[model samples]
Target chain A: MLVNVLNVISQWAIPLLLLIIPLYGFIKKVPVYEKFVEGAEEGFRTAVRIIPFLVGMMVAISVFRASGAMMVLGSLLKPITDLIAAPAEIMPLAIMRPLSGSAVLGMAAELMKFHGPDSFIGRLASIMQGTTDTTFFVLTVYFGSIGVTRYRYSVVSGLSADITGFLVSLYLCHRLFG
Target chain B: MLNLIWLFLLVSGILVAAWHGNIEVVTSAALQAARDAVEVCLNLVGIMALWLGIMKIAESGGLVNALARLLRPLMVWLFPSVPPDHPAMGAIILNLSANVLGLGNAATPFGMKAMQHLDQINPRPGVASEAMCTFLAMNTSCITLLPATIIGVRASFNSANPTEIVGPCILATASAMVVGMSVDYWFRRRNRRRRR
Candidate 1:
């Protein structure tokens, strides 16, 4: 019941905002189109500005993946995962979640396809993917856009959250769906 | 730290590839990743323009500020470094709201806008301010109410109940948020003391 309500809200949210913002602007005698165009000009510049940062971050991530480092890491971490009774298949998803968004999403879909979405692995993967954002990508784009080279402890904080999310997802999935 | 991670990825990747005799794969992956990065940025341009334009209109109509005011107390508490009436507060609020609603595309532009606003007030150029770090922490681990894309992916996989993970997802995300905020707070205090 709650999911249905959230689904409707998520679907309608953008369209509603698109309508309401301009309509409200028009009613308030604001030149909505002109303002929109002015703001949009920055969009092009912002996208261009983050190009170097994105390339640097993505190349490293891709190289890491292409070199089969993740698989090695997964194997190395197998003992702990086994001890916790978590499937080895889900380890790659957890490791990749904070590094790259698309990579983890692809893994989650593949897991669901291979294991069936109702299976424990599929459900666990789904929750893990949903609960965590791509920390490295976010840090790169957001901080890079503003040229913030000294991010201080942002990385530490983000990874801590991601780790917490992973553990919580594992525990919750086991209790709820196992 | 980012410097360390970048070096670690590159160094470890190359070493691992050499160990496995897969150096060519790493080389090709690097080139492909660079190209894909540009593609991702270009794709973002249109959506960024659309959202930024809408946001511009909202700002002009005072809607952004009004919305910010509606949640003034919460905004103040979350981002004390920002003035309650500042445009940064509004943009940050919009970004978080979009994130909560699972509007990833909308959230990005709003987040960029917020960062721009936050940067304007930053005393140190090229350094993340306290508010920026706090914002990033919250953003990277925000409580997700609707993980729309994941649900769609599950449904496409023929799950009997695609939304079954929603409750668990929310619980996990909420716990993540709590920890993220706490860690960010602790770091902020430590940094301040060191600076003093």
Candidate 2:
């Protein structure tokens, strides 16, 4: 019952923001249309600017997958992940989650379709996706747009965080849902 | 770091494919990935344009500033290099707020704008500033209050309890945020000490 209520609230949060922000802006007499067009124009330019970076990362990801490296790596990591009680099946999803959101989403959906969402592996995949961000995608798009080539320590920190999120998802899934 | 990763991916991919006599797979994957990249960007353009437009109205109406002021204390601490009232601070606050609400599409525009604003005040044009790294760390481990996308997927899959993972998701992401911020803080202090 409480979960239902929370879920409903969460569902409405974004819609409410979408409604309220604009409504509030209009009430305040802001030139909403003009400003929106200006920002949207910038957004268009940014979208174009990021195409090269997106292609580079996506190609790398596809190459990694097509070469069977992901499968090889997954198999290699299976024993370790199993030892930690993390489902070996979703190992690829976890690895790809920080790389490409769409790819990982596809993987997660496949896992759920195969295992059923209520299954342990499916739940774990969902939690993993929820808890982590596509670190490389964000880094590439945001930094690449502005031509900030020297990311320096950002990647380290971002990946470390992803690792932390992944582990925590595993541990939590086992403890709470197992 | 990105360079090394990209290089590693390409070299390992090609070498492994060659060893496996699956060179054909590599060629197809590259072509497919290129197509997928364009599709992803096209999708992004529509979402980004819509949200950025909404955000522009919010910005002009001072809603973003109000939100930023509310987040001022936290922002001041997290991004010490940025001024409290700077447009970057507002953008960061808006980005984070959007992320927390599971508005991923909405968050990107604000995040990109934040980076631009941060760049405006950046002393080094091509290099990421300390604040940028910290912001990236925070964003990568963004504390998600609701994993709505996951819930929707679960619902579609007919999960008995689609929302059951919410509590765990929140807990896990919170821990990630804590860990990420600490590491970022440690790196920043170390860099400062080295310069000193």
Candidate 3:
């Protein structure tokens, strides 16, 4: 019931605000268009600087997968993962969260193909689908942009959160659904 | 310096933990991981380029400007320190828009520009201003409306409705932002108390 109301409110909010802001800007002759252009130019350049890091992280993730390092890590971490009841299907999400999108997608697709849709693993994969933000990747980009040299605490905190999700979700699946 | 020690400690821990089970395999795998990393880097070359090209065109065609205007209110609320007319606010809006659409690939530069703009207004030369920390918190935990990459992957694997993940994705991210903001606020407040 609440979600429906929130959704309804959201549907109108952006459109209404967009209409009102520009109308106000134009009436005041605020040069709204040019100001927007100037701001956006900075946005464009900001996108460019992220290339090297993205490339590096992508390469690292690919190497891990290609060399079977990730599999090894999976095996090494098996005992812990089993405790959480994390199926092999969602394991890559654990690894890939700190990595990139394409890498995770590759893993997700492989899981879907190998484990059959609607199976336990499949549902877990589905759950994983909507969950998780790229914690390390996000921090690297945002903190690095601002030249944050001492950003260690958040790294530990974010990874702990991911681990928390892993443990709880695994417990839920095994005890209830699985 | 200290980070190197930490990395060393981590690597050693991994080696020690996996020693009895398959040390040699783990070692070889780590090397292989490095090699695979290079290959993965090659694969992404094209995808990133295509996205950047689209972003470039968006900039040239004034689509980015439209995006900024579209997200202005959210930007204002997020970065209350930056004046409404500030270029930083515009950059921030665009950065956030890219993030909302699951375009982390596109949002990096905008994040930088937002910081650069924030930097100009930094009253403290070395320390991050209150607004800057808040901006970082918001960006790091920016709520994603669509988990585009996940949806695409689900679709690639032939999910019935790839976009269904959007609901869960939005919920998770919004909650994360709320938590993130509260923590950030707490830290800032603590810092203020200390200064006083």
Q: Pick the DockQ winner.
A: 1
Order of candidate numbers by TM-score, starting with the best: 1, 2, 3
Worst 10 residues of 2 chain A by lDDT: A1-10
* Candidate 2 collision pairs: none
| C-alpha positional error of residue B114 in candidate 1 after TM-score superposition, expressed in Å | 0.5
Name the candidate that leads on TM-score. Answer: 1
Candidate 1 colliding pairs: none
By DockQ, is 1 or 3 better? 1
TM-score per candidate, chains pooled? 0.97, 0.95, 0.63
Q: Evaluate model 1: give its TM-score.
A: 0.97
DockQ of each: 0.83, 0.74, 0.16
Which regions of candidate 3 are displaced past 4 Å?
Answer: A1-89, A152-178, B1-77, B123-130
For model 3, how does the per-residue alpha-carbon lDDT over B20-100 read when each residue is reduced to its tens digit?
Answer: 455564455456555654454454344444444433444445555676677778767766677776767766776777678
Q: Higher-DockQ candidate among 2 and 3?
A: 2
The single-chain TM-score for chain B of candidate 2 is 0.96
Give candidate 2 misplaced runs (Cα > 4 Å). Answer: A1-15
lDDT of each: 0.92, 0.88, 0.57
Enumerate the chain B TM-scores of all models: 0.98, 0.96, 0.67
Q: Write the per-residue lDDT of candidate 1 for residues B46-89, one digit (tens) a residue.
A: 98999999999999999998989999999899888888888999
Q: Write model 2 residue lDDT over B39-108, tens digit each, in one string.
A: 9899989888888888898899998899889888988988999989999998898889878878788889
